[model samples]
Target: MTIRAYRDADLGAVIDLWRACDLIRPWNPPAHDIAFCRSSGHGELFVAEAEGRIVGTVMAGHDGHRGWIYYVGVDPARRRDGLGTALMAHAESWLARQGVLKVQLLIRETNTAVAAFYERLGYAVEPRLVMAKRLDRGDGQKNA
Candidate 1:
């Protein structure tokens, strides 16, 4: 598989991959997220293509001081083949190139299965609560 930056044509496939990997939720619309990243100028979305198919993705962004990763996913049938791990490594490398002081990603509290995946990559859980207040009236099941 080859990893490359996302293109406008890849939007639908990328969103479909996220859904296949159980990454999509009602609150965070994938299309809106993609549009924001592409328009913000500080974010990038990468895709993994194998056999002419989009199979994995990793979205990385920098908030000046730190880099954040989100929307990481891999084809369910393609799991355990190091695709997810490679996507993460790619994201970290991208962040390092941007001079980001730190790299962080939020994992859902109930997502115990992936904790070990991040932990194996040297990510540790920080002792901080992620408090939030929805500013958008449309926010219902805020999955972030």
Candidate 2:
């Protein structure tokens, strides 16, 4: 398999793969994936291609001081083949080159399996509550 930066043409396949794996919440609109790919100075998307097909994906980003990884997925048939690890290694290398001081990610609290996956990859949970409030116009009004 070959790992490479994402191309605009790969968007359809990437969205399909995420849906197939039930990776993102059902309420999340498909357009969000496109936005993530196009977001400026925030993140980069990558794909793992094998036999002319995209089989895995990852999104890596830096916030000046630290790097954040999100939306990592591998096709079900392609799991346990080291693609995830390879993709992460690529992200880590890129973040290091950019002088990011730390790397972090959040997994659903119910995803014990994935928590173990990250642990094996040398990631440990930070003992702090992660909170967020949407700032979109409709929600911003509620906060105000």
Candidate 3:
């Protein structure tokens, strides 16, 4: 299989693979395709192709300080073939190139298997809480 940077033409297949894996989270809206493709940073979306078909995908983005790994997915039929690891390696390499000091990702608390996967990958869980507040249109209008 070949790993390469994503083009607009690969969006459809990438989304399909993600949906098939049930990997979409609440924060990942349907419009992430547009946002991801247009984002400017040290990160990029990559695809793993085999036989002219996209089988795996990952989005890796980094500022100078930290890196994020998001939206990683592998086709069910193609799991256990090391595609996930290969994709992660590519993402890490890209982050390293950008001088990012640390990489992090958030996984659902219920997904113990996923946590274990990352643990096996040499990532550790930190003792910090993640908090967020969604500002609605009303709030924006008030500020305006």
lDDT of 3 by residue, 1-144 (tens): 999998888877877888997876555563574465447756688889999999998888875667999878889998887888899899888888878879999876676578766776788999887875557444533221
Worst 10 residues of 2 by lDDT: 135-144
TM-score against native, each model: 0.92, 0.88, 0.86
Pairs with backbone N, CA or C atoms under 3 Å apart (clashes), candidate 3: none
CA lDDT, every model vs. true structure: 0.90, 0.80, 0.79
Off by over 4 Å in 2: 140-144
For candidate 1, the lDDT comes to 0.90
lDDT, candidate 2, 1-144, per-residue tens: 998988878878988898876776754565675576457666788889999899988888887778988778999998888888999998888788878889999777576688877887999988987766666556454321
Model 3 shows how many backbone clashes? Answer: 0
Between candidates 2 and 3, the one scoring higher on TM-score is 2
Task: Judging by lDDT against the true structure, name the best candidate.
Answer: 1
Cα-based RMSD of the predictions, in order? 2.0, 2.8, 3.9
Segments of candidate 3 deviating more than 4 angstroms: 33-37, 136-144
Model 1 vs. true fold: TM: 0.92
